[model samples]
Target: MNSTNNRIVQTWIDDQLDLYNLAKQLGDTVWQEQIVQTLYNKEQHTQKRMQQDLWRVFDSINRKMLELFGQLKESSNSYEVRVLREQVWELKLQRIEIVKKINK
Candidate 1:
């Protein structure tokens, strides 16, 4: 990503991270680039690992979203449909973040 796109991704991730804090659950990943704080070769390795993890998480989220999609199509209950829609939306956002932040 370019600097502008990268900044947008970082800001979105930070915003999501803050939401987890309010929910009292902070298991979200926090990966950011810093020149001085990182060791020369180690920084590249760490970024690769983080990107791999994000890919795995993205796959899991994709599976869940597809499962929900089927249920969403078949559901007749308005409330259940609403809940499913929200879940799918949240997963979609996460997927977007992963795609943007991951090494391409």
Candidate 2:
């Protein structure tokens, strides 16, 4: 791959890594446990649905990252690599927006 495409893919990988770390930290927060318990008691149905939705988003993001990795591994031309890199960049931006909405 060309240098530019390599750099773009590297940035996308870094962003994904950052997100994985963020999710880990958020999951480990003490307040999260309290929130979960409260929601479980007061709004079990809504809480379960919300959790399912969150898991769906998390799984989708992971799948997309793996797909990007596969594309990077199989890319045979600079053009293909650049296209894959752009897709990853767009995915990263969308993931950030999803996180913002979830946090809100």
- Residue range 14-46, candidate 1, lDDT tens digits: 564455465445333342223222333443545
Cα deviation at 25, candidate 2, in Å, is: 46
Error of 2 at 8 (Å): 36
> Cα lDDT of model 1 overall?
0.70
Q: What TM-score would each prediction reach against the true structure?
A: 0.57, 0.49
Model 2, residue 24: distance off in Å is 44
Candidate 2's TM-score? 0.49
The reply for model 1, stretches above 4 Å from the true place, is 1-40
Whole-model lDDT values for every prediction? 0.70, 0.66
Q: List the residue pairs that clash in candidate 1.
A: none
